[model samples]
Structure formats: structure tokens, C-alpha cells
Target: MKKDLVKIIEDALKTLGIEKPTHIEIEIPQNESFGDMATPVAMILAATLKKPPKKIAEELVNAIKDKSVFEKIDIAGPGFINFTFSKKYIYSEIKKLMKDKSKFLREDIGKGKRVQIEFISANPTGPLHLGHGRGAATGAALSNLLEAAGYKVDREYYINDAGKQVRILGLSVFARYQQLLGRDYPFPEEGYRGGYIEEIARVLIKEEGEKYLKRAFDEVSDFFTDYSYKRMLSSIDSDLKDFGIAFDTWQSEKELYKKGDVEKALDDLKNRGLIYEKDGAAWFKSTAFGDDKDRVIIKQDGEYTYFTSDIAYHRQKVEKKYDEIIDIWGADHHGYITRVKAVIEAIGYPKEKLKILLVQMVTLLRGRKPVQMSKRAGKFITLREVIDEVGTDTTKFIFLTRRPDSHLEFDLEAAKAQSSENPVFYVQYANARINSIFAHAREKGIDTDMLYNADLKLLSVHEELRIIRKLLTYPMIFEGAVNAHEPHRITFYLQELSGMFHPYYNKYRVITEKSEQSRARLALCEAIRIVLQDGLEILGISIPEKM
Candidate 1:
């Protein structure tokens, strides 16, 4: 619908001997009395074209060729052209929407561009905490949103298997295993202290018994580290799966080292004169690309810094030919963005092609008081525990209720409520209520499907037309959300659409004594259901047909 309107306006400008701007902004009039859609193109072109704004508006209105698309084009105030869409046009669009949702709702905003989004690549040291859960939910919804907008997206998770964190996890399990076997070995000073460690120890005892009791720690360190992390990673995969997030790629940090990509990337930087030797250590000239100072890529002890592997990983991602690379990191990693983008620039990739989003930490509360400590994790709450307590739908919906970069206070009782306070319940109930309407229509021997052919012009009441007006603006909302890479927009939109429908439903009946009125209203209700379910699906939330 927007595309058609833009074309009409462009053609009108061509007739007036004016070259259109690259983007002619179309807006929905906040005051319904203005029109359905309004554009300030005349106001924008006035000073440059050397014509009065009202005269230009009049000339464009007189020049419009697609007269059937509008009921009337009025010049209000100084030069604003307000367009009220003809009822015939609105009926055609609503009919097309009810006939086929997929072809109607899917916009071509991406135009086949490929995007690589890497997120929630948490260390395999323990269960995923709430912070990780927020990233997971955002990543999953962003992937769905891009796909709906016609982009080919690769959802990825980078495994941090080549770090000290995983080694500590191995030592923790190794120490716990020895103790469970009656050995007197000491635990690592900074080992993880969660109850999950003891569970891993029991599993190792049940499987291997005292097989490693007589071996030196260094001799069997690889086996213990590999077994322990792999176990933790399995649980991670399961938890994410239950949360409705599955990644297309699992790039391993260890694989980057094993394949010599890290060494090759460092050599590339050195060849480009971005690497320098300082005090027997190799330093990267990150400041050359906007960093506050240069950073060390290799220490004097000949060990690679954490940033070294990150450079290799991003270099590899660029080689995959994705048009855009997106990294979703936590707020704690705020300062890390500039340095990472600097390495990408040093490696000859455009820094702007790399987009990084930071998700703020989540604060869990029971009503107003803060709830701390998880019985299972022994330190912080686990994503799995939250899912087990509330539900998969509530956990996901609550995480997405706020912008990922903003602080979110998730109330446990509010999320579990069955009333409108629970957003998930509110949105889900809208679809369920629509189903009941159709069921009631059938019980009265009124076929709702046949209403699709009804004279929808009978939907002339203020409230019915108001719902239609709101329903037709979905594409604009979707385009804005997609271009901004924000999925919380969809959550907020679903709530508003449901909010509109629930009040209207309480006062109106879908199956009335007047056959024509009932038919037109039933068609309106079905369109609302289609759009509500469509937005919910983009957020990856379930649509319940019954409360």
C-alpha cells in the first residue's frame, strides 16, 4: 500500500517537472481528521523550488493521476497534503490480506541481502544466566524479523573453547572428581563453586570410577577439560533449544587456533604495518583506527591475547561474504566495541559494516523486592530455572518487553498472572477470543469464511473504521523495526493491537441480527487476528487458540 502511494506521488511530481528526492517521507496523521496518510513533500520542496508551499501543494494535487486511490486530497494549514484512502482501496487491501497473509505481509525491505548475527556466545564455564537469556531472546527475535523482511540471516554462536575459563571449569570438575573418589587433591583457588560442579563429579565417578585417580593433573588435564566443558555445552544447547533459539553456526575459538587462522590474521596485520614490537611483545596499532591507544596482540611470554582470536574470528566472518556482520554483546563489554571495530578496519574491512548491539543486564524481582541467588546455580539465577518456574513463553516475552540496551525489571508475579498485566497472556488471549467469536458465528449458522466476500463497505462505524485504519499501518511499523534491528517494537505493537481489539470486542458482537453488519464486522475481526498472530510469530511467541 505504501509503495503504491509513493509511486502515485512520484508520478505526480514528474508531471510537475520536479525531480523527486531520494526518499519522500510518508507519515500517518496523528489527528485522524487530517487524513489516512500525509506527506510534507511540498513543504520540503518549497524553499528550494522557489514557490509558495500552498501553491506547490495545489499544483501537485491538480497533477495527481491515480485519482481512484484516494477519496479526497485536501491541502490543510500552509501546505500539508492529507490523503484519505478511498473505501474501495481499503476494501481491496483488506480482502487481499484475508485471502493470503504471507504474500501480503512480507515486505521486500532486505532485497536478498545477507546478514550474519552472532550473539549469546557465552563462555562454557557454567549455566546461562539471565543476562545471557536476554541476548538469546533478542537474537532469536531479530533473526525472525530480518527473515520476515526478506533478508537471509545466519544465526551464529561462537564457542569460547580456547580460554582460561573452560580450563578452570575442567580443574573444578577434576578436583571434585578426586574428592568423590576419596583422594586428597586440593581444588583450584579460583574454581567454580556451583552445585553443578558436584553433579559433574558424580557423573564422572559413575562413568570412569578411579580411572584418573593415579594420573598426574597435567598428564590428564586435556581429557578432564574436554569432558567437563562438553558436558556444560550440552546443557547450554538444551536450555537454548527449550527457549526456542537454535543457531545455524557454532564457530569454535579452539578451531580458529587449530586452523592457524589466528597466526595468519596476525601476520596480515604485521604486513599492513599495523603491528609493532614493543618491549619484546607484539602490539597492534588500534589507535590508528580510532582506539584510544594501541593494544597488545601477543605478550612478551609469546601468548596470544584474547583480542587476537577475536580479530581472526571477525576476519573469517568477513570472508564469508555476508553484507553485514552483527555482534550482540552485554553491557559489560561496552568498551570492547571500538577496539574490535578497529581490528576489522586494520584488516581492510569497512568498519561500518560491523554493527554491535549491547544488551543491558536483567534484574529479577518477586513483586517489588529483589530476588537473589539460585538454589541450582548457587550464585546467580539460571535461564533454565526461570523457564522451569514460569514458562518458555513468559520468559521470552518478558525478556523482550524492554529495549535490549535498557534496564529491565522482570516481576515474577506479574509474569505469572493470567490478567492483562501479563503481556504474554494479554496477546495470547486476543487470538483465543477471536476464535471464540468465529465459533459463536458458526453456532448461529453464520459462516465466517463467507463473510470474506461480504460488502465490507458496511464497516462504516467509527470504531470499525478506526480498527481498519490501525490495521493497515502494520507495514510501516514493520519497516521501521527492521531497519533499526529492534524486535521490542513488535512486542509493543502486538500489545497495542490487542489492547484495541479487547475493548472493541467487549462492546460489539460479531454475529448480529443485521446480516450485512455482522458480516463486515466478522471480516474486521479476522483481519485483526491475522495481524496479531503475524506479529506474535515474528517475536517467536506461541499463539493459543483458547485461553
Candidate 2:
């Protein structure tokens, strides 16, 4: 409906002999007094036409004399033109929603293009911490949003199993293994010290038997590291699945090394004159493409750096024929974005084809104080622990309540509290309440069959109009989320929309006073229920039929 109104305004401007602007932006007014829909096109064009904004707005108002759909048009503060559509039009929109609720909100802008979103990609050094959980929730929701927008989307988690971190994890586990066998060994200070390391060591000891303990420490460490890396990856995968995140691909860095892609990537860069030796180390000339300094791809010890494997992984993504690639990384890695884009540019791919989303850190809070997270002290919170304390839905929703680039505070008390204070419960309660209305309507023999046959023109209450107006905003919300590549916007939208419904329910009764008005309002309620269900489903949140 908003798009339709914009077209009408554009045509009205052309018909009035006022040169139509090249573009126009239409938005819902923040203040209800402004009107249902507002536009600043006249103010934007006044400078070019050498006319005052109000005068231009007057001309626009006069040009759009067709009062068929619009009930009123007013020029408010600063030449803002606001339009209030007729209640009849509002009813018509509700009817349209009732007729085509399933397909009303989705758009075909992506046209089935292949897009891969890789996120969290945390090394299997320890259990996933609070930060990894944030990335997982954000990436999973993003993949669902892209699919809703008509794209063929793939959610992927890259396991960093062939890195220094995995080696550290192995040493950490081997240290525990030897200690269990009554041997004294000094663990590396940089090695992982999480309590889970002991569990991994115990498992390895049980599986490999005592014969393996007789081997040299270095040999045992090598065997344990390989074994621990694979086991940790499996555990991470299972935890993510339990958290309602399922990845379509589990790409491994070890697989890249095994397939010789890492060596090939280095050779290609060297042949292209993009790599050179300096200080007995091979460095990539990333500065040629806007990096602050040339980065060493291979160190003096003849070992490949993390950046070497990353370049090969990106090349592998491009080889898979993905039209676009999105990488979700922590905010601490913001500086790496430039270098990664530089590598893509050097590899003959447009910089725009690859996009990096940096997610800010999440701070767990108990009230006013920040919860300390330290892996070395063995006092960090894992993603599994958060889910164990709060269910998956609450955990996922809280993680997505804030923007990916902003600091988030996860309060365990607030999330677990089963009251209106919990945003997830509030939203879910709205869905449940809507479903409850349908059950009551069924008991009263007031189903869709009866409502469809009744006159919908009777839905003229102010609360009914407001609910319909909020329902009409779904398409705009969907479009904004897709354009911004931000799934948290949907979470915020659901909260607001659900808040609107709760008040509407409190003020008016859906199944009371069996008049034509009651039937019409019930129809409106049904439409809202469908939309709420659809929106929550897109975010991977369950809409319970009952609380």
C-alpha cells in the first residue's frame, strides 16, 4: 500500500507540471498526529524549484485531488506532507491480507542468487564462549532472512582445525593426560586451560588405552592434538544444533591443506608478483591495495600464517560460484577486513562481491556489574551454559535484540524471568494470545467461514484501524532488513508489533457482543495472528499455540 501511494504521488507531481524529482522517500511518521504515511519529497525538491517548502507541499496537495483512497492530507512541521488513508482503504488492506496472508510479506528481489554466509568460525580450542553464541545467533537469523527474501542461501561454519590454536588445545589436553598418568610436565602458558580440556584428555585416555602413554611426549601431543581438534569440532557442531542453528556446510581448514589449496593460493600470488621475500619471510603486498602494511603470509620458520589459509578459503568460496559471500567476524578483527578485501581485489574479484560483518562483543550482566569472562582463570561462560540456563528461544532472541556492531548486555535474571519484562516471553505471549482467540472463536462458532460472509465494513473502531496499520508495515520491515543485512531489525520489529497487539487486545474484545462489528474485528485478529506467526518463523522463533 505504501508503494502504491508513492507511485500515485510521483504521478501527481508530473501531472501538476512540477518537474518530478528523480527519487522520493516515503516513511511512516514517528508521531501519530503527523498521519499514517509521510513524505519529504517536496522539501527535497524546493531548492531546485526555488519555491518555499510549504508552497511546494501545497502544490502537491492540490495536485493529488483524488480523494478516493486518501481521507485527508496535511502539511505539518517543516513542509512534511502527511496523508491519512480512508478507513475503507484500511479495511480493504485487511481483506487483502486475509486473502493472501501467506505471500503478502515476501519479495523476490534476490531472484534465487546463491549466497553463502559464514560466521562464528571459532577455533576448536575450547567450548564456544558468549561471543561465539552471539555470532551463531546472528548468522543463523541472517541466513533465514536471506532465504525469506527469495535467495538460495547457505549457512556455513568454518572449523579452524589446522591452526596454532588447535595445537595449543592439543598441548593443553596432553598436559592433563600426562598429569593423570603421574608424570610431571610444565604446560605452555599460552595453552588452553578450560576445564573441558581435562574431559577431552579423559576421553582420549579411555579410547587409546595405556599403550599410547608410553610414547614420547611430542608424539603423544601430535596424536592428541589431531584427535582433540576433530572431537572439539564435533562438540561445537552439536551445541549449535541444540541452540536451533543448523549449518549447511562445515568447511575445515585441514581439508584445504590436504587438498593443496593453501599451497596453490600462495603460488598464484607469487606468480602474480603480489608476494615477495623480506626479512627471510614471504610477505604479501597488501599495501598495494590499501593495507596499512605488507603482511607476512609465511613466517621465517617456513610455516603458513592464518591469513594464508583464509585466502585459500575465500578462493574456494569463489570457485563454488557464489554470487555473494558474507563473513561474520568479531569486532576485534575489524582491521582484518581491509586486508581480506585487498586479497579479493588482487584475486581479480570485485570488492563488493565480498562483504564482512563485524559483530561487537557481548557483555553478560547480572544487574549493574559486568560478568567477568576469562578463559585462563577458567571462569568464562560458554554458549552451552547460557542455553542451559535460559532456553534456546530466549537465548537467541536476547542475542539478537541489539545491533551486531553495538555492545549487548545479557542479563540472566531478566531472560529467565517469566514476566512482561522478558522480551521473548512478551512476544511469544502475544502469539499465544492470538491463537487463544481463534480457539475461543471456534467454540463460539465464529470461524473464518462466518467472518468471511459478514460485512467487513463494520470494522471502524480506532483500535482496529491501528492494528491494521501495524500489520501493513510488515513488507516495509522485510525490505529494510534485507537491504541492511541486519536480522536484528526483525527482532525489534516483532517486539513493537507484539506490544501493539497486547494493548489492542486489552482495550477491545475479539469474541464479545456477536454483532457484525465483532466478526469484522475477529477477522482482523486472525490476520494479525498469521502475520505474527510468519514473522516469528522467519526469525526461527516458535509461535506457541498456547502459553
Candidate 3:
């Protein structure tokens, strides 16, 4: 519908022999009394064409004469063109949604673009904490939104399974294992000091049972390193699955080193004169590409930096020929964006094709007080712990209520609430109420098969029309969320729809004495249910049939 309105304005500009702006901005009037859709195209052109906006609006309004599309094209408040769709057109769309909910979904905005979105690639040193949970939910929601918008999206998790971190994890487990075996072994100074390390040691003891007690330290270190990597990675995978997230590919950083992609990336930069050596270190001249200073890709110790592996990973993504590549990282990595983009340009790939979404921190609160520890993880709250506390639906919905880049204070009390105060419950209740209406209709032996025979013109109440109008905005809301890369917008839309619905239901009785009115209203209710389910499904929230 927005597209059709924009096309009409574009056609009007062409008919008048005026060159239009490269992009047109269309808006929904904040005050619904104004119109269904409004645009300031006339006002925008007024400054460019040196004419009064009202006069330009008049010309554009005169150019559009299709009464079927617009009930009225009025020039309102200085220059804005407000288009109120014909009642027939509005009813037609509602019928379409009821007939086939998929028809209301936006079509192919991405045009089958192959997109790779890599997210939640936490190092396999520990369980996924709340920070990682936010990334998982955000990334999964984004992948769903992109696929709905017609992009071929690959959901990937990059495992940082190589380097000092994994070795330290192994040492931590080994130290704990030695302690468990009554050996006085000093733990590594920089080893991981979490209870999880002790847990890994216990599991290893149960399995190996003193077999490694007298082994060489080198052999033990090697065994523990590989063992810890596999065990911790398995835990991370289990946590993600319990939190309702799955990845299409689990790319390993270890594999990058084994396949020599890291060296190849650095060598490519060197051949392009993008790298220089200083202080026995191989450095990339990132400052030339707008970085604050040069960065070391290879250290004096002859080991590749994390930045080098990241460049190689991204270069591998480039080689895969994706039209767009997206990385969802924690907010602390904001400074890393500049150098990563520079490397993309250094590697001769379009920097514009790469998008990095930084997910902010989350603080869990219970009522007015901050809840510090996870009962299950015994340290910071794990993603799985939160899911177990409040099912997957509430976890995902609350995670998305705020923007991914904004700090979220998740309230435990509020999330589990069954009242209207809880946005998740409120939206789900609306869907459940619609279902109840249909279920009641069936119990009353009302033949819903003849719903199409009802006269839609009977839905003349102002509230009924408002509900239909809000339902029609689903596609627009979906497309806007896809374009902005923010799925939080959908949650807001569902809340608004539910807000409009509850009052409308209370004001009007759907199962009326008049059979025609009852059927039309029920059909309208069905349309609302379909849209509610569609939006919730995209957010990975389930819609229950009963409250």
C-alpha cells in the first residue's frame, strides 16, 4: 500500500515533467484523523522547485484521479498530501489477509541476496552468559527478519577455539584435576578461575580416573587443551539450543590457522603494500584507511594476533561470495569496527557490504532490586538459566523489547507477569482472545465456511475500521524493521495492535444477533489473529491458543 502511494506521487512528478528526488519519504500520520498515509513530497519539492507547497500538493492531487485507490487525496496543514484509502480498498485488504495471511507479508525486498550474519561467537572458555544470550536472541531474530525480507541468510557462530584462551582453559582444568588427585600443583597465574573449570576436572576424573596423573606435563597439557575445547564447546552448543538458537555453520578459528588462511590474509595485505614491519612485528598500516594507528597482525613472538584471524575469517566470507556480510558483536567491540572495515577495504571488498550489529549489556532485575547470581551457573547468570526461569517465549520477547544496542534491565517479576503490564503477556492474550472467539463460534455450531458471503460493508463502526487499518500496517512495520535491522520494532507494533484490540473487543460484541454482522466481525477477528501470529513468529515468540 505504501509502495502504491509512492508510485502515484512518482508518476505525478513525471507527468508534470519534474525530476523527483532520489528517495521519497512516506509517513503514517501520527493523528489518524488526518488520513491513512501522508507524505510531504510536495513540501520537499516546494523548496527545490521554488513554488508554494500547497500549490504543488494541489498539482499532485489533481494528477491522481483513481477513486478506487484513494477515498480522498486532501492537501492538509500547509503542504502534506494525506491519502485516505477507499473503504472498499481497506476491506479488500482485510479479506486478503484473512484468506491468506502470507499475502500480507512484504515481498522480496532483498531479492534473494546471499547474506551471511555471524553472531554470538563466544570463545569456548566458559558457558554463555547473559551478554552472549542477548547476542543469540538478536542474531536469530535478525536472521528470521532477513529471510522474511527475501535474503538467503546463513546464521553462523564463529568459535574462538584456538589460542591462549583455550590453552589457559586446559591448564585451569588440569590444575583442578591435580588438586582433585591430592597433588600440590600451582594453577597457572592467568588460568580461568571459574567453578566450571572444577566441573570439567571432575568429569575428566570420572572418565579417565588417574590415567593422566603420572603423564608428562606436555602430554597432559595437550590432552587437556583438546579435551577442554571440545567439552566447553559442547556446553556452549547445549546452552544455545536450550535458549532456542541454532547456527547454520560453526566456523572454528582453529581451522583458520590449520588451513593457513590467517597467513594468506596477512601475505595478501603485504603484497598490496598495506603492511609494514616494525620492532620485529608485522603491522598493517590501518591508519591509511582511517584507523587511529597501525595494528600488529603478527607479534614479535611469531604468533598471529586475534585481529589477523578476524581478517582472515572475514576474507573467507568474502570468498564465499555473499552479497552482504553482517557480524553481531558485543558493544565493547565498538572500537574494533573501524579497523575491521579498513581490512575489508584493504582486502579489496566493499566495506558497505559489511554490517556489524553491536549488542549492548543486560542487567537482570527482580522487582526493584538487582539480582546478582544465577542459581544454576553459580556465577554470572547463564542464558540457559534465564530460559529455565522463564520459558523461551518470554526470554526472547523481553530480550527484543529494547534495541539491541541499548542497555536492557530485564525484570524477572515483570517478565513472568500474566497481566496487561507485561508486553509479552498482553500481546499473547490478544491472540488467545481471538482464538476463543473462533472456538466459541465452533461450539455454537456456527458454520464459518460461509464467512465470505457476509457483507463487509456492515463493519461500519469506527473501532472496527481502526482495527482493520492497524492490521494493514503489518507489512509496513515488517519492512521498516528489516530496513533498519531492528526487530524490536515488531514487538512495539504487536503491543500497539494488542492495545487497539483489547478496547475494541470490550466495546463491541463479535457474536451478534445479526448473522451477517457476526460473520464479518469474526472474519475481521481471524485476520487480526493471523497478523498477530505472523509478527510473533518472526520474533520467535509462540502464540498460545489459550490465556
Per-prediction TM-score, please?
0.94, 0.95, 0.95
Question: lDDT tens string, model 3, 48-163?
Answer: 89999999999888877565778887899989999899899988877876776766666568999999999999988888877888898899999998998899999999988888
Give candidate 1's root-mean-square deviation (CA, Å). Answer: 2.3
For residues 1-547, could you state the per-residue lDDT of candidate 2 as single tens digits? 7787888898789878877777678898889778889999889988999889999999888888576898889998899999888877877777777777756776666889999999999888878888999999899888989898888999888988887888888888888887877777777798788788889888888887666664666766678888888888889889988888889988989999999999888888888899999999999999988999999999999999999999999888887889889999999999899899888888888888899999998889765567888888667888999889888888888878888999888877767774346788888888889778878877876655635445777776777777788888788888889989888888888888888889989988888876566677778877877788777887788777788
Better of 1 and 2 by TM-score: 2
Model 2 collision count: 0
Question: How far is each candidate from the true structure, as Cα RMSD in Å?
Answer: 2.3, 2.0, 2.3
Backbone clashes, each candidate:
0, 0, 0
Instruction: Write candidate 1's Cα lDDT for 126-223 as tens digits.
Output: 99987898999999999999989999999999999987788888999989888888889897878998988989989998898889985787888899
Residue 77 shift from truth in candidate 3, angstroms: 1.5
- In candidate 3, list every pair of residues with a backbone clash: none
Model 1 weakest 10-residue run by lDDT: 412-421
Report lDDT (CA) for all predictions.
Answer: 0.88, 0.84, 0.86
Whole-model lDDT for model 3 versus the true structure?
A: 0.86
Please list all clashing residue pairs in model 2, or write none if there are none. none
